[model samples]
Target chain A: MQRALTLAALALAIAFPMAAVPLDLDFYIGFASRVMIYAIAATSLNLILGYGGMVSFGHAAFFGTGAYVVAIAMTHGIDSLWVSWPLAMLVSGIVALGIGAISLRTRGVYFIMITLAFAQMMFFVFIGLKAYGGEEGLNMPHRSVIGLGLNLKNDATFYYVVLTVLVATLYLLRRLIDARFGRVVEAIRENEARMETIGFSTYRYKLTCFVIAGMVCGLAGALIANQTRYVNPNLMHWIVSGDMMIMIILGGLGYRFGGVLGAIVMLVLDEAISPYTTYSKIVIGFVLLAVVLFAPRGLAGLFDRKRVRAGGGHG
Target chain B: MNSATRMTEPVLEVRALCKRFGGLVATDQVSLDVRPGEVHALIGPNGAGKTTLVHQLSGTLPPDSGSILFRGDDVTHLAANARVLRGLVRSYQITSIFRQHSVLDNVALAVQARSGSSFRFWRPVRDESALFDEARAVLARVGLADRADVLAANLAHGEQRQLEVGLAVATRPAMLLLDEPMAGMGPEESERLIPLIDGLRKDVSILLIEHDMDAVFRLADRISVLVSGRVIATGTPDDIRANADVKRAYLGDELEAASGGEA
Candidate 1:
């Protein structure tokens, strides 16, 4: 019964963009694409924070870098996404490797602070690069062409592309969460010292998780750059990182659709409430507090009927 | 498995190990060796630095000065996980199994540690029948096969202790450092664990740090008594029973009480 509901939801997501195109609901379509991009970013953060137990506060470093990578490549006449998108992922991955190597050595709050420091450092580095428009931000010449005969310039087409990416990302992440790697990562979260005594080099596993999250978030950054046609140092700001964290918590930490649900709700609330009130944040804050006080597991956790049992499936 | 060939040399050798915390000496010039296929028991009173010595041996705590040789390789500098990979595994005095995991998963993780690289990111671990099969075999060995699907935290204290030993044993250790595996157990629970350790002697050598004199005498091939962070005596059970130094330092009336209770 739940499976049918989930499939129906997916079907709605696919058909909604097509229906919105004819109904002149272009603004909603663009908003939906933005939500998907945020969903990808939040889900990537979940891999490290929720699963691996690494509370990184500098995820924006990767997200901004991915956006910058695409914008910079387009300025250099690299208009094909085939080259720019992978470049964004690769660059973010390498950056994550370097940051993770240093940051993973410290645990708990120190880990969080160190990651934040690295991200702020990246933010400043980009700000210093006057050639890339510095604090003013850079504008893309045009959205990178897919060359597959689809018009990325169309809002509906871009929404479909983002939905496809989100679905693929979710599928791959699900596989990863159920795999041996995920089990080890989760075990490390439960008891790291035990993992070491059990012969696991836990540092390496954590570093890998950090890199994967960074790479995926980078993909989101690339899509967002295409969607907005703008890249800015503010994308790497600590506020962005905090926002992504909020989305994960709002959706439900460790659940597969936690990030996606959180992104949709958060974005929808912002869109609907901001027009009427300047205190929209205060309203959202109360909602978040209520969720924490009542639900404790976020929005996605509400659908779970049975209490988690021993040897049960994980998200 | 080839216990005969390795019997000529000590499987583990600790030399002049010392650890000092400021003015206090926790472990002073401690030294011991466990021969292949033998269960060497280290007995001591409270604050005798038995746990400190175990920490140093297992690479959790670095001894201020010591040389530890495992399988003839100097592993004093190796990390805990490195030592584990070399088949030097330890169970905690305070039962440290993964509390959130299932009883089967707790052992399966240990088996997975020893089997292959945990960097495998594609296939689900549930689909790995061989890993689960080996884990079940380990659970059966530790007498937890019936409770394999139960959450580890839900187990009774005695059963959790069994799972603790089960975790170490599943790692396929060459030498097991069991730090009071039967701690906080009733007499009946302790009675059940005696044969479990006894059964492991065929394939694995054991360095047991236990306070239970009955368990020590029954399981140990040789006994070393530690008092005031020093080895007072090292000999066979009967030999140590006769040693006056062992009597005065740690045992005193405890051995008599153990024998009396056993009878």
Candidate 2:
């Protein structure tokens, strides 16, 4: 069921290929790419929080780590996309391991608070870097190139790269969620005590999941840095974590495709509402409040009974 | 089917087991032995500490005192999960299970745990044919093969109890702890359950705790009666039923019929 959903989403992505001639099409395509990136990050959280029953509030550390990797590598007279991309992923994975080792010891609300503290510490360090544009941020002199055949600076080329990577990630993540490891995580979510009696060291499983989530979030961070062509301490702020949570909530926390739909809806609303009034933050806050209060399960619950419709099946 | 063919070495031996809760002594100096493929029943009234002994044997709770030997190794302070690896699986009395998971997934998870390296991420266990075969076989054993895809939360209470035992059996443990598995069941449910449990004794050593005296006497080849944190008697069902102290502690008037008394 999850596989079919990923394939359908992939088909939609390929058939609509966003880099074509229509100017407005480019805007929607760009909107979708951003949405896909957020969905990727949010989905990683769902893997741990929703499935593994872990609630982490400091995921921005991995995000920032990824961004820093790309930014730092690019500024050092190196514009090699091939090198920086994987390097960024590896760095994020390491950061996740370091943070997860300590933070996973704390359970429930304590886990959230500890994760938040780690993220803040990292954010403050980034802000303190006087050479790397400090608190303001840094503009990339050039986009990283894979050399030989690829010209990444072209908006069309980069958009498709982001799109392709997003689809592949969704495929891998969907498979991971349905696997035996995924079952254990979900089982842990359902009943850790019962799991223990059956002979599973739940802590090992949780840490493994925590690292996977962090590594994936790191990949999303790299994509975001590319889209903006900039890096800043703001990327690692707790508010960003809050934004990811909001996206997941609006989509319905555990609804697979609903998470993607939520990111699209939120970004589109932000864009639309900002034009009507300058107080977009206030409007976004009100919209979020309404979604939480009136739509407890978010937009997906609006179609609670209408599950398995024509739009997509088994997502 | 016979106890003589069971493990030549005892699967578990409790040496002076004791569990204390501040002012209360839950399980006091209880020593017992369970051999593989044999049925050893632990029977007592409510608060006789049968459940406490089960907890300590399963390693969910470390004994406040005394060592537990399983398969010739001392597993006194081992974690609940570690004992499970050594083939000591236990089912809860409360019918606890992962309700949100499909019946297949629940059993598959236990299979995965027993399969070793439950952290394997590259391949899906559901795709593994061996896992499917094992889950189906265990579910079939509990007479739940038809409901493999059903959500456990939606199952009837008795069906849930069956699945609970089915889950323990899936792990292929050397010894099984069935803790008051028939509690709150109607007569028909009990009729179905006894055969399910009886079938299990053929494969594994079972230590069953039950409040139902009839079921205890019927299933247990050897019965141990516990009272006020101590084992008052350890003998065959006929011997336990005839003991004067065991009569006063539990069964009371019911003991007379089991003893074949004229009164």
Candidate 3:
């Protein structure tokens, strides 16, 4: 039954933008695109936070770095999606490697603090660099050129691109979660000392997982930059990192669709409620509190029919 | 005891292992050896540093001064995982099985460690039938095949203990540092573990630190009594039972009880 529902959801997602272009509801296409981008970002956070048990509070460092890489690449005559997107991911992965190497040495709260410190350091570094518009940020010359004959400047076309990327990201994440790498990662999360005793070099696995998450998140950043046509230091702020973490927890940690569900719920709630009240954040806060109190497993747990085993993350 | 087996080199050799915390010396010049296929039991009272010695041997704790030779190679400075890769494994005194994984998965992960690099990111682990097959065989050896699918957290205390050993056994280690495998087990649980441990003697050497005197007397080929971070006696079960120093240190009351139960 859940499988059928998921298929219906996928069908709706695919058909919605097509129907929107005809009905002249093109504005929602861009909004839906934003949701997909955030979904990717949140899913990357989930990879480390939920599955690996690494509470990284500096995801925005990679995301913002990716955005900057794309924007800067455009200035240097590398505007093609193929080159810039992968470059963004590469740069973000390098950043995660540097940050994770240091951060992973410390665990629990220290890990959280160290990651945040690095991100804040990145934020400040960007803010100080006047060449890239500094504190005010830089605007993209235009949306990244796909060079694939698709008009990316159009909202509907861009929405389809983001949708495809989101689908691919989810598929990749699913493959990873089912793979031997995922098994080792989740087992390490469950018990690192035991994993070591059983002959696993846990630090290497965790660092690799962190790098992968960063690369995926970087892709989201590149897409978001194209969507907004701007890059700012605020993109790497600690608040954005907190926002990603909130989405993961609010959606459901360790569940397959938690990140996507969280991104959708959070963004939709913000969009739907903010117009009605200036104090929309207070309402959101209350809702989050209610979820934490009543739905300890987050929003995705509500849809699950099986009582997930006590220690096992969803497959 | 055959002269050929006695003349064979010890699988693990520890030389003057010492550790200090502030003013207290947790491990005081502790020296021991495990023959290639004998259960060498270490019995000690509370704070006797048996666990500390095991921790040092397993590479979990660094000794202030010591040398550990595994298969004649000095492994004192090797990391814990590296030591396990060299076939030196240890089980915890506390039950430390992965609580969220199934019994089979817990063992499968151990089997996965020695099979190959776990960096295979594309193929699903479910497709790796060899890992599960070996893990099932390990579970059966530990008498947990019936509970293969059960979550480890849901297992009874004794079953969890069994899984703990199962995990170590899966690594196919040449020597096992069992840090009180029967720490919290009931008499029946300890009884089941005795033959299981005895059965393992054919494959690996064991350095067992156990509080259960009955299990130790039944399983140990040689017994070392530790008191105040020092070896008070090292002898055969019969020799240890007759040793006055062993009784004076840690085994006085338990020695009587063990002998009575034996009779």
Best candidate, DockQ-wise? 3
Candidate 2 DockQ category? acceptable
How far does residue B253 in candidate 2 sit from its true spot (Å)? Answer: 6.4
Worst 10 residues of 1 chain A by lDDT: A306-315
Instruction: Provide per-model DockQ scores.
Output: 0.59, 0.47, 0.61
Kindly report, for each predicted structure in the order presented, the TM-score of its chain A compared with the true chain A.
Answer: 0.96, 0.88, 0.97
RMSD of 3: 2.6
**Cα lDDT tens digits for candidate 3, A1-315:** 777977898999999988987899888999999999999999999999988999999999998999999999998888999999999999999999999999999989999999999999999999999999999999998989997688789988898899888989888888998999999999988889999999999999999999999999999999999999999999999999998998888898887788998889888999999998898778778878888788878888888867574644322
**Per-residue CA lDDT of candidate 1, range A1-315, in tens?**
667977997899999988886898968999999999999999999999877778999999999999999999999999898999999999999999999999999988999999999999999998999999999899987898898888799888898889999998888898998999999998988889898999999999999999999999999999999999999999999999998998998998887888998888888998899999998888888888988888788887888766452431221
- Put down candidate 2 lDDT per residue, B8-107, tens digits, no spaces: 7688888898999998999999988887777889988788888888898888887888889988889998889999999988999988888877788788
iRMSD per model?
Answer: 4.3, 5.9, 3.8
Q: Which stretches of candidate 2 lie over 4 Å from their true place?
A: A1-21, A24-32, A278-282, A285-315, B1-6, B120-126, B253-263
What's the ranking of the predictions by TM-score, best on top? 3, 1, 2
- Looking at candidate 3, what is the lDDT of residue B151? 85
Judged by DockQ cut-offs, the docking class of candidate 1 is medium
Q: Estimate, for each residue in B101-131, the C-alpha lDDT of model 1 and write its tens digit.
A: 8999999999999898888888999999999
The residue-by-residue lDDT of candidate 3 on B103-222, one tens digit each, is 999999999999999999889999999999999999999999999999888899999999999999999999999999988898889988988999999989999999888788889999
